[model samples]
Target: MKIATYNVNGVNARLPVLLRWLELAQPDVVCLQELKARDERFPEQAFHDLGYDAVWNGQKSWNGVAILSRVGEIHETRRGLPADPDRTQSRYIEAAVQGVLIACLYLPNGNPRPGPRFEYKLRWFERLEAHLGTLVSLDAPVVIAGDFNVMPTDIDVYVPDRWRDDALFAPEVRAAYARLLKQGWIDALRELHPGQHIYTFWKYWRRSFERDAGLRIDHLLLNPLAARRLKAAEVDRRPRGWDKTSDHAPVWIELSDKPVRARTRKDASSHR
Candidate 1:
């Protein structure tokens, strides 16, 4: 199965670009972030017409997340982390699609570091860490995918020196991201193409996309079961170059038909 994550930036404004990319990529499942639309404003019928069933949590003009599956019914599991009931941003949404648990998230941008926004970002990451810890412990085939809004390592950014003071590349933010990986989830792109300069997001200014000056903030993280089934992962940079496209491109992973299972002695003999 092919699964993808895209931060559309503004769903409505970028609908055409998004539709064109969807046609070309044709992923079985997709996690979308930054819808920038309200629940009622979401173009459900548009996706339905594209033969995809979607479950989304949308805010008026800010954070939002959605899961779209072309194969199975998307059964929603949750909206946001239980750690913060007062958190009203529509940044998270989880669903079960094609027997896999998918968590779509749009983490806080946390710009202008050493401020309250940065603090909120850390707090949000803590909640995510707690929630992901519970999910990974279950050892289910889970994929937590979307725009994490942080450059976990210097390798993830194009010009590390320029972004030293940026929240996305800050030491504390990177530490939080490391804590998440310690929970046993595999960063799909990095795991697949280690030591390669792969990126999923580019800025609109300064000809960032033209120059391929980008960052790998958008991610598809897999739990143990899903990681075992991982066949390939990539950043679809073509869409990022399209007309009026999102600053972020799509990142995807392909998995085998079935989840990997431990081989028993009898099973091993049968294979042999």
Candidate 2:
């Protein structure tokens, strides 16, 4: 099955672009972030018309998250982190779809470091890390996907030197991200394409996309059971080039019906 994550930026403004991409991608499941709308404004009927059943947690004009699936009924498991620093933000939502626990999140963009906002970001990350630790050892497949808003490594951003002072690439944030991986979740894209320069987001200014100047902040982290089923991971950059589209493109992973053999070559697997 194909599972994808996208930061829509603004659900209402990007509705056209989003619809076009969804039609073309036809993923089995999708996790969306940055809806920038209230719960009542979510366009639930639009998704319903496309055969996608969804559950969303939306904020009026800022953060939000949602899970959409056509493969199975979306059984909501959680809506926010156990210890969310700011309860007001609609940044997280989780659900079970097609037998997989999917966590969709829109981490805070703590810009302008050395400030309270940055502190909030770290606090939020701490809460998320603590909560995810509980799921790492689950027997079932678990997917943690979202716009993490951090460049975990230098390679994830276009210019390491230029972003050193940026909250998304700061040493502390990167360290926090590292600690998250130590909890036994695999960074699907990086794991599959080691050393390759892959990006999921680009700025509207400076012709970032045209210049291929981007960041890989959107991610899909998989638990052990889910990692074993990972067949492929990729970034669909087509949508980023669309008119008035979101800065982020879609990142996706293909999972098999059954776990791949222990010694099987990643590219050669044929899971049941």
Candidate 3:
């Protein structure tokens, strides 16, 4: 199955662009972040018309996540991070679709580091790490995809030196990302094309995309079982050049049926 993730920046603002990409990519499942809309205002009917079942967690004007699956039978597992007591932002959502556990996330940007926002970013990573630890115990094919707002390596950015002080490339942020991968989750894009300077996000200002200056902040992370089935992974950068486009483009991964074998074995062992 083909699974993809994209940070549309704002669901309302980029619906047209999103529709075009959806038609082009035609993924089996899609995870969206930065919806910037309220739950009531989400354009569910549009997705419904395309034969997709959508589960959305949205707030007003910022930080929302949603999943759309053409395969139908979407079962929402959770909405928002558990450890967060405030539950003020709609930044995380998880669902089971087509036998795969999918998570959509919009991690905090945490710009202008060495401050409260940065601290919050680190704390958020810790919470996410803890959550992922629990997910691994399920022994299912799982994928966590979103705009993580992190550059996992220097090769991920166009000019690594230019982003040294930015929150996305800071050592602390990279370490947090490393910790996530250390939990047996594979970075799908990197796995497909190692040591490649590929980017999925580019700033609108300063002709970033025109100059091929971008950062690989968006990602599709797969668990060990899921990784075993990964067939292909890529960033669809062409969509970002379209009119009224989001700063981010779609990143996707294709998985074969190998993971089902591992899942079945684990299930059998548990029953013993």
Q: Residues 60-87, candidate 3, lDDT per residue (tens digit)?
A: 9999999999976899999988878659
lDDT of 1 by residue, 18-113 (tens): 888888889999999999998999998988889998999999889999999999988999999887865679999999887789999999999888
Stretches of candidate 2 exceeding 4 Å from the true structure: 261-272
- The residue ranges of model 3 lying beyond 4 angstroms of the native Cα positions read 259-272
| Pairwise lDDT winner, candidates 1 and 2 | 2
Best by lDDT: 2
lDDT of 2: 0.90
TM-score against native, each model: 0.94, 0.95, 0.94
Better of 1 and 2 by TM-score: 2
* Candidate 3 residue pairs in clash (backbone atoms < 3 Å): none
**What RMSD, rounded to one decimal, does every model reach?**
4.1, 3.6, 3.2
On residues 1-272, what C-alpha lDDT tens digit does candidate 2 reach at each position? Answer: 89999999999999999888989999989999999999999999998888899999999999999999999999999999996646789999999987899999998889889899899899999999999988877768899999999898888999889999999998989999998887777899987999999999999999999999999999999887888898999999999998999999999999999987253343222121
- What are the lDDT scores of the predictions, listed in order? 0.88, 0.90, 0.88
